[model samples]
Target chain A: MKDVSRLKSVLEKGGFAVTSECGPPKGADPQAVLRKTELLRGKVDSVNVTDNQTAIVRMSSLAACCLIKKAGLDPVLQMVVRDRNRIALQSDILGASAIGIRNVLCLSGDHQSFGNQPDAVGVFDLDSIQFVQAVRNMRDQGIIVGGEPLSHPPDMFTGAAANPFADPMDFRVVRLAKKINAGADFIQTQCIYNMERFDRWLGIARDRGLTEKAYILGGVTPLKSAGMARYMKTRVSGMDVPDQLIRRMEGVSKDKQREEGISICVETIERLKQTPGIRGVHIMAIEWEEAVGEIAERAGLLPRPVIDDQ
Target chain B: MITAQQKPIDEIRGMLVPYKRILVLGCASCVAECAAGGQKETAMLASTLRMKAKMNNEDVIIQEHTLDRQCVKDFVVTLDDIIGSYDAVLSLGCGAGVQAVAEMFSEIPVIPGLNTEFIGETRAQGLWVENCLGCGDCMLYYFGGVCPLARCSKQLFNGPCGGSVGGKCEINPDVDCAWQKIIDRLSRFGALDRLETIYPPKNWSRKQGGGPRKIIREDQQR
Candidate 1:
């Protein structure tokens, strides 16, 4: 209950505060990170940093989160306990807090079988919900993993992922509430495509009291081109794209599809911002975060106030 | 890729011909790769054992299990059902693997179905042959990396005697003289300086030692 007043205030601006994602470099280089932050520094409220993002090794999320903090931008550190045991998770949380990294997104992470090392083994020691609880245990009790008291305990805002479009989506809200009860400070959702269906899920989420328990961040991704739209429509599952968007995409030339894309993304943001009960929008420009601010401004969603004054 | 090692299938069937219950345990790593005993092998053995038992006028309860690794403790810790349900184990891996099973499960007698071969290397498709003697010390560096301890017929330090003809060993004309191959390879690499230095008589105690040898890596262990 230490004032989340600043974070809530940041979201109040821009009507639907737009946040963007940036993937760290494949190797240890931090240049890609600096460029992303520089491009959208003041345009967005905070930046979301991905962890190994899709089973490929890169710069660690904690290191990138530290860099983002040094760059004077708020960071949402993503952590996956798939490869690490409880011992590693506790230490990493402390490491992030030692620096100024505050927000953390708990995830079960991609299955190792899907990575380049297919023959390699997988270790799913703890799921996202359990990870959130361990972070709470570390913060509230100041207890070390071995039951000894640590000199300093970390204060991090923990969050978890939710996908309303997933099969048996009913369980998603149920799990989201479980995460909040487990001490999640906020919830950043999976990419949203069908606003109507998502709005209906909001009803389920509202019934469970997820709205008041944590800051809910609805997610959006800009389809840069028709191929990008095709990739989302075909490659990613549990995503429901309305036919109207696809039909509109069919009329545009492949060369000009990206322009049409920016237009479409602007419209999606415009509609979501107007939807009741939605707290904020998490923008996934899919590597084109440069377009995020422009899309937000074009959608007439700029000039947002931090947190809801109502 | 396939062979029987621990208490042969027929032998176990013969012993349990009068009994009404039978169980088969399988290992999935080494044995599975060799195609001798794994999940597939266990299912096959179970069905065959059941068929043979029924033909001889008896009903048998047969069960099959394939543990991830029988040698490792973590993989075998969740075996409460397996230990109590089975009458015997028909491990089809090497002698070390069968011994591991016996050491872990002492109440029930364990049987071997396959003859455990020496530490082997795959020579071709579905074929494996012994390559090393597990000698305590390696002498390959002096012989141009060709090990006479394994390939040479007489384990000769300096060889290809007068009896050898056309680079073939005297004892077996069909087998190429391993020492001749070594000399040819060394000469090709122009490192024959290593060959002129004669080797001392082989040390038997350090290698082929009577007791098991162990490597204790202090840093690695922790």
Candidate 2:
């Protein structure tokens, strides 16, 4: 778990571990991803390459992660258990791990109906908890997806998503415990705006004895504008925005909301740093990345620490 | 057979918007069986788009084609030569087939005209309903062939909730109660007493993610 400790200390020394998302275009335009890396090159810790995000279909996540790596950036290749079964999932684990992608995030993913193509047949074969186990199984058991012995084992830090605001918050902690029991080394959460409620979730996680077992990263996304804020608040499922944050957005002019959003994000990071037991924050700026450096600086997450090579 | 259903249109012109050149692709595998969007739906969309284009005093090209199977690569390869001619492709197959087309031609911009609903089988003529969420585990034997996991609406692991009234789901009167069906089937088979034992919650892991769920014969493995 020293890798986990080193990953944490790197972020703790400076600011949060900011991760941006890259949605590859449907057409054969690798530039959609390459351009982003050029902009975020050396600016962030790692970029998450999505897997057919809305399930409308696009370039493969494995391919995009490879491109991100080629562009001199660390990529957390994301895998969704929705379209793939356990067999395909374990195969994909070998596929990604063999490619030298060490960081992987497991997501249950939005249902097919929520994607661009509704009416899409879903392949649930495995959900979130099961996904973490598959990753862990590959490393420890040394068994391939086909139950064959692998010549070389994969070194993957298995991680899964946690939604603190899911209907019953306590159930999420139970799910987290299940993740730890299932062999999840790290946990990245859904976007958090309601800090007070999220802190309560941390207390619940502590009570469940998940503090020492897994690395927990709070999910934070910077709302670039008032429209984006409102869309996330109302449209995005399983998301809730505090009234004060809403009021703060309402007070700002349309043009300044972007800056106000950065400020709000800074405020969130500062508040998050004070909270005990939280390992780090996974900043999802959505499409906004240039503002990330400024927010980190404003939050006093400065003076990058020396790199700890894996 | 892949059961697919189509929503009938007063007319089909509403679907082809802003695109003058349209390609209508249908699947004979699933959608074709249900008569939802199969070949019939493809033709309907094609003619409807042509009529709509004519009324607007603009020229529109609708090239209609249906493959033997949409899910298979060999069948999809049928469009390999002619795909470059079309501006956009409208698929009447499930979402999987449409994505395959999109993957086949990254630039063609295929659009879906039919909504690929649940993985259902037609009980009789023109009736297809969802039977399972494919939770990766099957406890069908314990429930006398009735799945409380899928049909119960609440996905209850136990028997029917108090909500199952008159052998119908509380949410909808028309929908038959999953547990009730189970109880009836079990009683008929003298397996009804099995319901008394409390069933454990599902372990979704065995269901899929430990690895890709596979059904293969080493004998069949090439």
lDDT of each: 0.68, 0.71
DockQ of each: 0.01, 0.04
> Least lDDT summed over 10 consecutive residues: which range in candidate 1 chain A?
A1-10
- What docking tier does model 1 reach? incorrect
Q: For model 1, how does the per-residue alpha-carbon lDDT over B1-222 read when each residue is reduced to its tens digit?
A: 233344566676666644445557677877776667778887888788878766876666877777877666666566665677777776655566667877777877666665765555666777765556667878877888777666654454543222234566544556666666677788789876565433543555565335776667998865
Residues A1-310 of candidate 2 have per-residue lDDT tens digits of 1232234345545434555567666767898879767766555566777788756687888889888876666778788766876778887778877777777888766556656777676765555665676677678998744456777777776776777775434345656677677777777787889988898989988876786688777778877777777887766656777767878887989888888888888888888777766766777776665666776678776543446663
TM-score of chain B of 1: 0.80
TM-score of chain A of 2: 0.90
Best by TM-score: 2
* Clash pairs for candidate 2: A86-B208, A86-B211, A86-B212, A87-B211, A87-B212, A87-B213, A88-B212, A125-B208, B6-B36
Model 1 spans > 4 angstroms off: A1-16, A144-148, A303-310, B1-222
Quote the positional error of residue B84 for candidate 2 in Å.
48
Fraction of native Cα-Cα interface contacts (under 8 Å, chains A and B) also present in model 1: 0.00
Q: Write the per-residue lDDT of candidate 1 for residues A1-310, one digit (tens) a residue.
A: 2323234456534245556787788877788789888877766767788987766787888888788877877788888765676678888898888876777888866645445655544443455666777787777888754467878988777777777765434344655666777778777877777888888898888887778788787888877776666677655545677777777887898888878888877777777777766767788887787888787678775664444332
